[model samples]
Target: MGKITTHVLDTMAGKPAAGVRVRLFRGAELLNETVTNSDGRCDSPLIENPSAGCYEIVFSIGEFYHIHGTESPFLGEVPIRFSVEVGQHYHVPLLCTPWSYSTYRGS
Candidate 1:
């Protein structure tokens, strides 16, 4: 079965980015949204049986940093755009700081 999941780790705190709001979208269409758990993972898979198309992950970075009491200029949203092939499991993990972030295909 095709599936997609993600994790977020706060490098500044050396822990998971718990309680961070995450929104998934397929182009202009909103698919689903949820908050990350203590392990920085969504409680459920973000997508399953996803068609071959473009998907974007919106992470509420500014708010997350605020909650963590990190100094920030509120640089706006963090969005990661990726494409999924048919019938595959996609794991995207984000390692973020208050000012910047990075993501890649994860196991």
Candidate 2:
């Protein structure tokens, strides 16, 4: 079985983005919602046994910065859409700042 996991790094702060809200969706249907831990990772996989299909993970960029004292963040929300394959682990990590962000497939 395949699994989906994620973590967030604050580029500006040079640390993990703890307490950030994360939401997972299959198309328009929400599958799960979670918050990042102190290490900027989820406690468990977002999808322990995922099927092959399109999916999305929405990160609360604006809210995270606001709590960290950014009065007006440039990026409000960051939503990443990707395709999953059966029996493959998908590690979609977010490296972000208030102004920009990036993601890629990881081990």
Candidate 3:
């Protein structure tokens, strides 16, 4: 079965970005809302039995930075949009900091 997963890493701190909020959306409809665990991974799969379509995941960056003690974070909501195909597992990993972020498709 196809699935979608994600994790956030704090590049500046060199650790998993725990407590960050993540939201998944299919088009304009919200799918799920989850927070990162101590490992920076959602407690459950964001999308299970996934189908092919366009989807986006929004990361709550500003709040995370604020709680982590960044007075002024450069980014707020970070959204990553991509398409899913049949029979594939999509692992979208984010490496971020108060100033910058990056993502990539992982196995």
Per-prediction TM-score, please?
Answer: 0.94, 0.98, 0.98
Which candidate has the top score in lDDT?
2
Of 1 and 3, the candidate ranking higher by lDDT: 3
The superposed Cα distance between candidate 2 and the true structure at residue 74, in angstroms, equals: 0.5
lDDT of 3 by residue, 1-107 (tens): 88999999999999999999999999999999999999999988898877899999999998999998999999999999999997789999999999999999988
Per-residue lDDT tens digits for candidate 1, residues 8-35, read 9988788998988999999999899999
* Candidate 2 displacement at residue 8 in angstroms: 0.0
**lDDT score at residue 31, model 3, on the 0-100 scale:** 98
- Residue 15 CA displacement from its true place in model 1, Å: 0.9
Backbone clash pairs for candidate 1 read none
**Order of quality (lDDT):** 2, 3, 1
Per-residue lDDT of candidate 2, residues 1-107 (tens digit): 78999999999999999999999999889999999999999999999889989999999999999999999999998999999999999999999999999999999
The lowest-lDDT stretch of 10 consecutive residues in candidate 1 is 68-77
Clashing pairs in 2: none
RMSD of 3: 0.6
